[model samples]
Target: MEADTYTQSAFEAELPIPRGMARIMRFSNDQPTNHVFRRGAHYWLDLCLTPRPEKARGCYSERWGPHRFERLGEIFLVPPGEALHVRTDAGDNQASIACEIHADSVDHWLETPLEWTDRRLEGGLDIVHPYIRSCLSRLAEEMRHGGTGSAELAAMIAGQLAIELARYLEAISESPITGGLASWRLRLIDERLHRGGSTPSLGELAELCSVSIRQLTRGFRSSRGFTIGDHIAQTRIEMAKRALASDDSIKSIAFALGFASPSSFSYAFGRATGVTPLRFRQRHLRGRE
Candidate 1:
């Protein structure tokens, strides 16, 4: 696709690499906007250069089979021939570096035919790979400052990026994810939990992580060495402890923490800490005295 396809962002710089091209785009809009990216004959790997505003009404949403959104510092990869629809909310000031690598380059790097039908190769919306991020950041820095031997440096970075991407695809296609949720996903989960009001449901958490409930459960356990429910309970208990240290009434704290009732909150607190809320607060007060 042509660079003009990204009308939401202005092209700040472009670098023609070996069998690929990289461009930096800055998105600054005052109103919500939608952009459709038609599939082209190249793989598109984009890295966000700015932090997404936490309080924005709606950040970035994609329409690729399923609706998904991406966060700050996350990567979104679109395979060749796969169309993408993106919606950005109002008041978004974001910058990104996109590298468009031809399919031939990918095949060469992988030393195998690209499998478009493979679910793993269908591309990801929330990719969190450290090496890829580092490569992209290097490219961004180069693009920002075009000095001596910049072209050669950009080409080298692109080659490393391509090889790294190939390895990532191969690893995912060949093996199952036995690790826990990525740090970004975990941060999202924590954000949802502390965003105030009621605790998020399992389904909500799964949706936030862009995984099925079963996958989230298994991945969380594998990564955290504890169940997600256990983590949530622990978080609630910690919040309760902090609230107890204040002058807030136990009933209000219980209600604020999404417990059905004070009795239920006390029961959970006692079960978790081996002490009632009142006793915990009294102990803290005594310690202060």
Candidate 2:
């Protein structure tokens, strides 16, 4: 695959097509940048890979403030004509990938109701699923290497991405957001949890949402089928899985996630997955062999 290189404003983008229904590009910026991504006719996916995942920040809507990212491999979907503003940390070179997929390809794989095709799946959809991350990582590697069979790999990944997006939309529809809470507040809670912040009390959550505790609890339960505390635990486990896969030490990950001690973290992890963190990491590592 050949690369289409260009520079616009302060950022440089390299777009490469390797025989697929998706167009993939990598972007790099040396300084803080404010650019509105003009939408095309197709749906889009963007993933940030630089400035350390934890330090990444961006605003999907022009009206909203930027927020710190909680996990790596988070996927943001951009609907046509909608603008996304991204400003990376200063003094660090920012790296990201933006892939544009044709709507027809998505429609073919998605089994959900027909109306969801028009829902847009909302931008800034955080993707913490390991399987999706694995597929995207392979697609990215092929995009960079462009070796033999790269075209086939790219096409397969493109189709897989569409399938996953459809499944995600279906899941969201099953737990549609209820009234009584602002969207920004929900985003705030998500950001705080991903940053390893302590699980917030019901009163704290209610105050942030500007609603009574009972209403907030009822709203969350109705939408997610779980309490806020359970959601926090689940999020922390997901983050822990990512961290464990990295080179970071288990003790460090435990502390980063706000656990009282390494022992406590191990206990919690064991209880959640029926295996120790070390054993889980080892199993995953072996599977990669």
Give the top-scoring candidate (lDDT): 1
Give the alpha carbon lDDT tens digit for every residue of 164-208 in model 1: 888776654434446668978988887787654687799999999
RMSD after CA superposition, every candidate: 14.3, 8.2
For candidate 2, write residues 126-221 as lDDT tens digits. Answer: 444444545565565565467777766677777787777666555554444555345577677777677674566778767777878888877765
Worst 10 residues of 1 by lDDT: 52-61
The weakest ten consecutive residues by lDDT in model 2 span 1-10
TM-score of 2: 0.55
CA lDDT scores, all candidates in order: 0.68, 0.56
In the predicted model 1, the residue pairs found to clash are: none
Q: Clashing residue pairs in candidate 2, if any?
A: none
